[model samples]
Target: MIDDFLDGSLPAVEEAVRKAAAAEIMPRWRQLATHEIVEKSGPHDLVTVADRLAEAHLTVSLTALLPGSVVVGEESVHADPAVYAALRGDAPVWIVDPVDGTRQFVRGEPGFCTLVALAVRGEVLASWTFAPALDEMAVAVRGRGARLNGTAIRAGSPARGAVLKVAMSHPDYTTPEEKAALLCLDTEGVEARPCGSAGLEYLAVARGALDAVAFSWEYAWDHAAGLLLVEEAGGAHATLAGVPFRVTGANVLPFTAARDQATATRIRTLLTAP
Candidate 1:
């Protein structure tokens, strides 16, 4: 069933994402009221009416598109942590981050996007990343490659001897230990900056606009869509343990998604260095 959907209905899923963004997200951008936005964990972690409503809209539209599928959404998990268990269950799961950069959105910045990925038993099969404000939609299907705005894109390797451009987790979201691993990027041959919008950063890696991304956390909604996009675009991702990242959890911290396997290995080596 899942394969059948991926084989032919990708455009339908993309349209659903665009509709959710247009109906629930874009309307609230730069127009949010004081009462509509609130902190979830701290000042850095935010959730707004747009995020909630968009996720709700996608939940309904997506599940309806593929009957019997479940959703593991950021807002849904925030409301009920148990909902995340669907990722490991037998049902096909839609991992969604309706508003990937709430802070940027609230500030009227155009760096945010909506992310959705279809996964079954821990393997992501397809993904969509839509940046409505920027008028871009990136899609990826397992083994079929990735595309942006209907055109194929690739994550070409960085030039020889060029400094690797890496978008890393912000210090606020990292543990002291994870922070230490990320600090390793500060060495020569790498230019690292705090990430903005995990989805867009992953898109950057997929399209070769950016060299790589180093994230300390592993929320399925945040990484699922982007990781598959990078992979289908010929990029690679690795964790501190020198293995591919696993969306199902228990990955070593400060994982990297790079333009190619060699870059991924180099980043992994840096993360493991003393």
Candidate 2:
């Protein structure tokens, strides 16, 4: 089936994406100026030349690798929603955020990365997050276990009354689901903070930097790779609806152990309506 595409092509894809991202990003990362930073909103929504360059490189390379596919990109959408609507529905698609942590990148922080995903029809088939700055790559296929920098990973066992450490955002723009996530953190007595960037938030949970992650909503490029990484890292990652991770927003994702599954599930119940 398509497994070969992942087995044979994944390693190659990870390397190419990493090189492309680094080439377009690292040089401009705080060390030098690529372009003037522009704020999308309140100075947190940021854009830079590196983001554009990295996405451009990814789009070109992805076109070569899978000419039969179309690309759905973050910048394209930001530039114009029309670009998103114009994507070819006739073929598979690559969902990409050339640089997921734009604010982090602009701020010269290490939390930002390149997020890429391949989806057929409406289901995510494969995904990757290349954190070039950290020399780490997280990759995942539909059924294959997720891998971080090529190492096998799994979810940890659950715990009880866990002091869940979580990542959050200001409740202002957050959907009802996001608010519930923050509530769960407070209810569970876990420390929580707005870690910034969907990619970074998920990475922290996968690496044990945080115990769980609850978000209002996330797009495919934002959560696809990270979802796989968390699951592969031996952690429970599911939306409030308890669905396998999807790009849908207004959803809460909780990473917990077996012991906390019940608690996590209870909290997730509160997020179901949205």
Candidate 3:
């Protein structure tokens, strides 16, 4: 069923993503009231009405699109962590981060997006990243190439001898050990900055505008869509153990996704250096 849908119903999924953003997100952009936004873990971690409503909207619409499918949404997991177990269940799972950059969204910045990935068991089969305010939608299917607004895209290898530009997880979000691993990117020939939105940073890597991304956290909703996009665009990703990242957790921290395998290996090496 999933294979047949991936072959022909991809656009249906795309439309579902776009509809969520249009109906629930864009309307609240820069117009949020004080009561509409609230903190989850801390001030830096926020959840707005837009996020909750959008995820709810997607949950209903997506499950309706693919009967028997389940959703592992950020807001839903926050409400009930047990909902996250769906990722490992037999049912097809929709991993969703309804608002990827809630902090940016609350601040009226246009750097946020909606991320959705279709995963069966542990493998991501298709994904969508929709940045409504920016008017960009990126789609990726397992065996097919990636696309941005209907045009094929690729993550071309970075130039030799050129400095590697990397977006890394912010220090506040990392443990001391993970922070130490990410700090390895500070060496010569690599420019590292705090990441904005995990999805957009992955999109940057996929489109070749950014060299790579080294993220300490491993939330499937945050990395699932982008990782698939990067992979379909001819890029590669690796955890500290130098293996492909797993959506089901227990991954070596501070994973790197790069334009190509060599870059991913180099980043992994740096992350593991003493």
119-140 per-residue lDDT for model 3 (tens digits): 9999999999999999999999
Global lDDT of each candidate: 0.94, 0.66, 0.95
How well does each candidate superpose onto the true structure, as a TM-score?
Answer: 0.99, 0.83, 0.99
Q: How many steric clashes between backbone atoms does each model show?
A: 0, 14, 0
lDDT of candidate 3 at residue 103, scale 0 to 100? 89
- Tens digits of per-residue lDDT, candidate 2, 149-235, equal 777655454355656666655566665655654555554465666668777667666666666666655555677667666665656
Candidate 2 total steric clashes:
14
lDDT (Cα, 0-100) at 48 in candidate 1: 97
List the lowest-lDDT window of 10 residues for candidate 2: 251-260
Q: Mark the 10 consecutive residues where model 1 has the least summed lDDT.
A: 170-179
| Backbone clashes (count) for model 3 | 0
Candidate 2 Cα errors over 4 Å, as ranges? 32-35, 85-90, 175-181, 248-266, 270-274
Residues 1-274, candidate 1: write the lDDT tens digits.
Answer: 7778888899899999999999999989999999999998999999999999999999999999999999999999999999988889999999999999899999999999999999999999999999999999999999999999999999999999999999999866689899888888999999999999999999999998899899999999999999999999999999888888888899988899999999999988998885
